[model samples]
Target: MATVLPEGTANNTAERTFDSLNPATDEVVGTYPITTPAEVDAAVARAHDAARFWDELGFAGRAQRLRKWKSIITRRLPELCALVRAETGKPEGDAQLEIVLAIEHIEWAAKHAKKILGPQRRSPGLLLANNAASVEYHPLGVVGAIGPWNYPVYTPLGSITYALAAGNAVVFKPSEHTPGVGKWLVDTFAEAVPEQPVLQLITGFGETGAALAASDVDKIAFTGSAATGKKVMATAAQRLTPVVIEGGGKDAVLVDADADLDAAADATVWGACANAGQTCAGVERAYVHEKVYDDFVAKVVEKVGTVRGGSDMDAQYGPMTMRSQIDVIRRHVEDALERGGKAVYGGLDSIGERTVQPIVLVDVPEDAAAVREETFGPTVTIAKVRDMDEAVARANASTYGLGSAVFTRGKGVDIARRLRTGATSINAPLSFAGIASLPFGGHGDSGFGRIHGPEGLREFARPKAIARQRFSPPLSLTSFSRTKATEKLVARMMRVLHGRSR
Candidate 1:
């Protein structure tokens, strides 16, 4: 694959370089610099300075620039999608879907940020009605975003676009395995606004990410495994720099007895296997009502059989993006079978050279890793539950509450609301991700903070409240000339307005 980075970023020494390999073919995709600490700091320093200019542009100017950037990505989507497929081993169609959603978010942020973060008048309450109060969200200066390999473009852009719309420069640290995709985005951003380095890329390993986490940036946004997120938070804590952590999740799908079994099964398979199941909100476990568990399992098995994984266009999915994750997938599947679970579909032998055939385990122990932890592979565990209540209970039992889905003819929304996840969809598969107007994030081990919609605009900004005196009050509460009689009058007024009835 061709390099996406600018000229100066290429490394000259082998030790200082890291190669991104096509997971399906195990071929070198491209090599990127193992950005040093100094390089990371320099990039942040540049973004820090650029933030002043970006912030000065105000919402209107920044939104226009962001829209330009969004247009460029939309126009060159084919090229971007191909690069995503090359680096992440995802199919071009899947890659396109991700970029398409990302572009939509950029558009939404550009169009709505000004309205969402602009100054708004507010009541000063009964005690201060004479004063005029208003509040506006100000940019938090430079923002450092560490991206994940899965859905790299779309996921990172969730924060990057909102930050830019809120008028903050961004220093992005793309996953080392997908640096080229990151570079493409930053380079295209530079094209939109040629005069400024508002968005910069620093491609490297964990050390580079660590430096950025502790840099002078006003805030950090990280998306990755829960363990790494903790380390990032710790590093940022040294300077009391705030962070938005989008951590890992072991999401589940709850199927109700009254639900449409065929639709539910189809959605479940897609949610479990799409993008090789590396999605943070991907469904790794399914809880089906006992009345329809057998039928649902049959549909899932039939649908799964139609899907295959490879580097070819005919394949439904691609290989695991991270080579090491192959073992994790194997371990989870094997452990499930060893712990008395029966494979309703693909089994241990389904694991191949670089691809893992869709594996569906039924009756897997509730405590099994296949059901408890994030497998991050094209595998899922199906269990029969007594009722919707049982399904909800089991789903909520997970410690990672990132995303969830419920399939029910009647109680879909009710069950979805009961789910302890950050985002839950009713009778649909990961629908929340496609909606740009909704905020996305997780709770507990899934991490905190939102990225999208009104909440997202404020996430990258600090609200500044202003209270201006409109007219002089009858009594000068702040003046020493205030008489005891006036103070007593004020006390009487307070008692009348807020005192409890006797």
Candidate 2:
């Protein structure tokens, strides 16, 4: 199996590793390897060696092992949740919530892998009447995944579980900000299946991730900024490795005229503020119908003000996981205010070095920085639209097409369908991410390829199609034993079949 001796284990090279610090507290949590391209190559070679053994185990065997891993995770939920909280500085409840969703995905991937990816019969087309056809999804050997810090457990596990279920060995590079969370995960996997290192962990900064990207992995699954996603793609391009790039987004929420204002407000506040507004699919902008704009904004502010950010147990949320992001959040807020925006709730004063209270801006311009750029913080910009059509047009104006939401009474589902995004929640916000069976991903600047559901399983596996001649046909088009008479007959048959349509 593929394995890397974690830091302080066998390869105690202190100079080559870095500290994993709590961005919220500025305290060192753990130290991990700064993996070089050479190390990445070694890891991928190990994973390649393990992949054959894993594939030979077949679907039933793999599913059993995956279920075992899931059991281990569920049994030790509290410990893992605490580790996540410490590394990411999220509230305990929020950490548990994300881990619970990750567990669901693992369960779903285990139970559905065989049925979704195993060989099945395919229809023989008219041109090959005597041929029997089938297709089976085969594992793509070793996969490399570079994960993000936001929702560390959930985001990375979405790739890791689906890859494992599809019978591929994985070499995971967890974010520098959340190495402890990554260590806990990999250690548990090793414990669950000690005989085979089907899952492995490597830790470091951007250079380590870039090294993995350029390594000889069968496929790359990355969840990070679009800028880094492009770099990953470029590095993988050297080896012609396929990749699934799930990048950032500037998602929006549309509030229709007849929508339930209270529900919309509640969903928006929770979606934008949950995880300290560090969510990739979080609602950063909202377009409300003019008829109910006043009431909707009022409710959003009222609910958001009640939420608090702190490190204690009673707080609703916690500090920002990355201190640098605090400045990014502040820049967007400050720019909006300078461009004639009004702060209905929290503003520049709410942004602290460690934590940021949720900020709500009103009447921000369409071209303003806050509205155009991705502000991955607990912030939202509200604008009044003439109608639902205008709301959707304004929402789709950006270069992002990740996750979106629509709040409406009778036209909720219809409006959601109209939005040009990968996932949409009608009358709810970021709810699609929780459904394990629904494929989660985005398009345009949000990046392509899915990380959940059957699509996700197939992302790490390649389809192998088979065709066999079941029986002999009287008219054999594929045989070279045909004379001019047979050729004439075939032409006549083709004419009969398709001449009228043409």
Candidate 3:
């Protein structure tokens, strides 16, 4: 029998329930109360009520509370990791790493929120020179977050931590596959600020998430599949609500002819197999210079063969949390095989009941589904090119451009900048995710807006510009009293400041 949620739990609507299973054992671990539409609305209303109190606290007070919360999370990091591992079936070490990184983001946001979101003076321009102008960021009241199961802690915390630091209350709806992780985070925040409902959780299936999107929240921050992101945006359009969508990625890693083959292979193995290849920025395709293609493929195959997947401690990877993902992984492998791609390490039979061993493919046609789409599995398709130019062209051919990496010794930075993605790292894979200062997001089909660093704080707050006249100017332009002489002066100033020839 499936587990049932406990009655009278906080935020429980008692309308429906869903089971969270241990991916490794296929045993039901726990049941979460599926919130109804009314409950989602109630959570939003409570967030609005809490926002007034939270916004009134200002930056310093809010920063202090965030610091305290950060301390709490840091001290209990292991406990939280256990919950994450249990709910998401990720390795314990990986879970711990995500929590640590999340804490770093929280600390950084708490320390820098004021500097990033505070009021600042701006030039009123010559036309409004008589008026003093300043702009300040205001809270968006309540923000609703619909997160993903992979990297459950880090992905959602990217939005939640920044939103709270910006003085906006949050109503988080974690992935149905990982509600326990969500509940643990919100419960910890509640312990820090028991007086107000600043952070709340509403757990349920897609309907509950849809309800939250359609509700009256000021903004919605969603991190999931691109398809669901489109649905969320469509629903929010009804009320014309603002949203920041951090969807999927088909990111690639380019290895130039001058690159170190061994280092490139190591990075590829880790990037493709880590977290069971569930990372949004994880490398799904690899473009290698044909000059060194054979050496790179051999090393990657050797390295991937050393890694295995299981729930046991000795294994390097774990099982697929969602059963439906098995079919997708199998189909991608089958498609690649049929399209003339050679599987160097594993094949279609490598996909087990729950665990999927790492699969490395080489000589894959660029148009293959495995190369063109977001597999979100521990599979990588590597192709060969004649030069750096061809490698770059093949890398940029995809529709999604979230995060990418380059492994050349000297030209890594230049190549990284030209990848048409949001974030890129040189010599290392997924290193940008660790830096709290750089903005994390994507472009094109990967989704719009950002959710980390300064951009994240600004995303949760609306800019409010204040202008007040301090003194009368020698030449006025706003009033009807403006003369041709004043217009001529303005024109001359414009020509001086913004002339066609610099």
Candidate 4:
């Protein structure tokens, strides 16, 4: 019943719109409006008005509404997951997993916002003993969230739910490739809090996203490529608006000599190929100790042997949501082979018009694109290292340090701590993202700012510090009426308190 146009296409007789297609079938799944710059600005204006009402609903009231929305999503999980599958071309199981994670985040943000953002007393210290101080987080007026197509539901909601829980209104701009999923989330949220447009949606291509970044929103939370993230930052700089950019990662997995060969292999295969390797933090590189390198590669190659990517129901994963990625995957794999890498499993022929078969290349040069770039596809490059030190060194050499996993018995946490990544899973791949209490983000080119946990709630709010004079100070330092004697006393006291460390 609904119709739309492609990106940048204009309609002579009606409002401009675009169609979202099923990546697997190449069939139109749904259509959404091609929201223009004017519409994005108007949406931001509405969010500012709604922000006051939403913020006034204190933590308790906001939590109640958020829980209702959570319940709605949980009860209709299957229906929403089905829509996600159709729109994103991920398998139904993968789609369900994404929704389940999103629901968990919503519940966590609702329950913890008060404890994390409410007013808290602070010690004034000896220098200001007469003053009582406290700090509370106040919501930013409005947040602009630009989401990615991969893991569309879970990823965007990370920003959306936390911002709402922090008492800020949100304007979400989902990737054009998955507009239907974005619309579904906003529509359902409205049903829960019909009183205000607390969460709104804007759909289109890059132009729409650029407009959002350049809008009057208080902050921008973006998840996409590093190059694109730079553009968003440049645009937001025009207004000097703050932003959180989760650029993609060339994440790595470190396999130690004492690690469980089988388990490490299994984690590597799944981490590298899951959701057709569309994940931003997916494992793109593996550095295994020379002692266990051969065994780990053997097990991983065996595990990948059973993996399949296609439109069939039995397939392990679905087609590439963005078709352009297929060529990128092909190029990376070919480049690795040309540079003397050996394909332990699939190779150049594994890349297809739609889906990519699991490809495992061993002995790939560290400087190869397959190892250095964020190849968002079902591929991984494995290299042998002399020891855990070398493995850690190679893993930390990447310019993008979003996520990493370290597999070892006694040194799991130690190795994890040594790696320079936003979050590291000690024994499991991407385990940090599943923990609702842990803040998830990255360093270096993978982008900055955080989502999830208390840090996430604080990301969308500003800390307002408060101080009150409860009594007269022992030293009247504020007054110049008796400064000569007071100054001498103050200098003596400062030396006594700060000149030496206890």
Candidate 5:
């Protein structure tokens, strides 16, 4: 794989580098340059220069290029998925699913950027009735996106694609674990828009990421652990660079008594185990109504029992993308077990060399690490709640609230409203992530800012407000010419409009 290098470093034979390994077999998939701080600066400078051309392209010009990029990705779906599977160690289908969602987001961002970010008329209000006001979103120049390994394509592109569509150049530093996948995306983007390096890639370890954060980018978009997010924020603080951090999530699921048990079980199991539960928004803990706790637990356990993780094609999922996370899974399971939790399905033995089989823990205390922290493994804790009220309370009691799910026949929407998460799915798990029209991101420890939807398109751009005088105001309140009478009239108007007893 070709690693995009800095201008002066092309001939440096002694440049540092690192190898990306396939988590399953520990085989070296590819080697990437450990981009130096100077190289990162070079990339950011190039992005800044490119941003001028990109911004001048205007909405229609940018959308046309984005659509071409999207079409290239759609046609090469199989090839991209193969690279994703090789780097991330996820099942082929799972990789494809993420790419498909990414493609949809690219389409949405391209088609909607004009409508969402274009200039729009705003009501002038009574005081300025003669003035025409409008707001338009302009690109933030250059965006520095630091992606995560688990959902490399879908997550990073969430920022990269949208930033490009909004007419900004992007300097992306994907996860060290999935550099190949990141390189593939950048390469394909070059294929689509070769005139300018609107999107560039720099691969390395945490040092490289920090360099990009501290660089002179207009905005920093990071997806990783909250601890790391804090570090990114601190680094970017030096420049006062704006940032959107999509941090870790300890998402929950609420199963109401009236929920379809079979459907709920299916959603919960798939949500918890899909991609080996590496999903930031995956169901890490679930609260079931007492009336259906026993039945729901049985269903979840039975489904989890049959699921397996391996490198084979028939495996339900593949190994953990990052081998170090294996210990985190082990510790959480042990902690839950020591805290009186019982494994209804796979247990301690499920934790393997690089893969974790589905493990469902019941009776795990809400305060247990497994239930409170982001395990990022195929393990979920189920607890019984007396009522939906209790379930909602317990579910909302988390520092990280990225995404959530509520299963019910009658109260799905109502219950979803009470959730403190970024996005909540009714009768399903992770449904919000697939919808390009819905914004993604979370509150508190889950981080702030959104990534998908109309809100997402606006995230990378700055709003510019304009007010033009359509005609001179008859009252002439601002003029020194007879302003007292106009001021009195304005006060009376304010009273009539706002000072109402009703």
Candidate 6:
């Protein structure tokens, strides 16, 4: 039987209840507080009230407190990882790695927020020469985030940390499957800053998330399916609220003929099987050079066969966190086989109730759903291409352009640049996610906006431009006293500067 928590409570009272189950055993882990529309409104109101104090604290004071929060999280890393592992049913080591990355982002954002967000002088155009100008980033009063179940800690923290450091109060609504992890993060923030509620949590089902989207928050940061993102944006449009979406991806990895097969195989195995292949940036498709295709597929299949998925201590993969996802994984596999794709390793029988064994496919059609759509499972489709150009072309054919990787000897960086994705790894798989200095986001259907580095800090804050008159210009165009000669001079200057004939 499933456990059910109360629908309404002092911490978070609402009119709905949802169950969070342990995927490994198909048992109820715990029930979370389901927030109603009224509760979501109250949370947003409190965040707005708290943001006034938080925004006034200035970047230095905010950084100091954020540093304290980082320390608390770093010291309790093991404890936090345990919660992550239990809630998401992922390996403990994987959980630790994710937490460490989250810490790195938090530390980076805290240290760099002042420099990236502080006011800086701007050069007013020559047309407005008499004016002194400056631009500064201002916080968007309250930020709402709706996170996913995969990599629950790192994914949400990407937005939560940056928004907080940018001087905005955050009202986060984590996936219902991982509410405990969300509660722990919010509680930790409370420990760091007891004076005000800089971060708050509102838990519930889709209705609750919908309420958050409709609430009066200045911005919404969402990470989930593209379909859901569209709905969130549509709802937010009701209030003319802005949004930053980090949606799904059918990412690819390209292997050149001159690439190291060993490294490519290892990356393909880990990328497709880790977290039971529930990663947004996981390798769902691979376009390898025809000359090296056979060798690469053999090695990847051998490595994948040795891996296991269960609650066992030695298991490399874990059960699917969301039970409903099992059907989706199964459907993709069946569809692939039905469309004349050959599975080199596991077949349709590999998908279980909670755990999905690794499936490696070769000779799959590019148009097959398994290859074209976002499987988001531990299944990868490998195709043979003529050369690097074909590999790049096939990789770029996908609708989702989140992250892609290339394994080669000489032209890895150059090829990475050619791929039309947000971030690219030269010889590594998903290393861009760990580098706090590099911006992390995507373009096209993968989504817009950024979540890491300087771009991320700016995303959370709006630009405030100030211009003051310092001295009278040679020709004052703003007033009616401007002469025709001055206008003629302006036209000549424009022609000389911008309209010059090539």
Residues 304-352, candidate 1, lDDT per residue (tens digit)?
9999988898998998888778899999988888999999898988998
- Candidate 3, residue 126: the lDDT equals 65
Best by TM-score: 4
Residue-level lDDT for 387 in candidate 3:
83
Question: Candidates' TM-scores?
Answer: 0.96, 0.96, 0.95, 0.97, 0.96, 0.95
lDDT of 6 by residue, 1-502 (tens): 1111112223233635666666787566667777878999999999999999999999889999998999999999989988888888999999999999999999999999999989899999878888989999999999999888888889999999999999999999988888889989999999999999889998877778899999999999999887778888888888999989888898899999899999999998899989999999889988899999999999998889899888887889789887778888888888888889899999888988788899998888888889888888899999999998998988999889999999999999899999999999988899999999888888777888899999999999999999999988888788899899999999999998899677
Q: Tens digit of lDDT per residue, candidate 2, span 1-502?
A: 1121122222346577677777667677777777777887888888898888788888888888888888999999999888888888888888889999998998899899999999999998887878999999999999998888888999999999999999999999988788888888989888876777778888776667777887889999998887778778888888899989888889999998889999999999998888888999999999999999999999999999898887777777788888878889988999999999999998999998799988999989999889998899999999999999999999999888899999988998888888889999998878899999999888888899998998999988999999999888777677788678878988998899888954
Better candidate number, 4 or 5, judged by TM-score: 4
Worst 10 residues of 1 by lDDT: 1-10
Q: What's model 6's overall lDDT?
A: 0.88
Error of 6 at 501 (Å): 3.4
Judged by TM-score relative to the true structure, which candidate is superior, 3 or 4?
4
Expressed as tens digits, the lDDT of each residue in 1-502 for candidate 5 is: 1111111112235868777788888788888898888999999999999999999989889888888989999999999998899988898899999999999999999888999999899999988899999999989999999998899899999988889988899999988888899999999999988988999999887668888988999999999888888888888888889899889799888999899998899888998999999999998889999999999998887887778899999899999888778999999999999999999898999998988899999999888999889999998899999999999999999999899999999999999999999999998779899999999999899999999899888899999999999998888877668577778888999899999988
Model 6 pairs whose backbones collide: none
Query: Which scores better on lDDT, 2 or 3?
Result: 3
Q: What is the C-alpha local distance difference test score of candidate 5? A: 0.89
What TM-score does candidate 4 reach? Answer: 0.97
TM-score, predicted candidate 1 vs. hidden true structure:
0.96
Clashes of each: 0, 0, 0, 2, 0, 0
Which scores better on TM-score, 2 or 6? 2
Clashes of 5: 0
RMSD (CA, angstroms), candidate 3: 3.8
Q: List residue ranges in candidate 5 displaced over 4 A.
A: 1-13
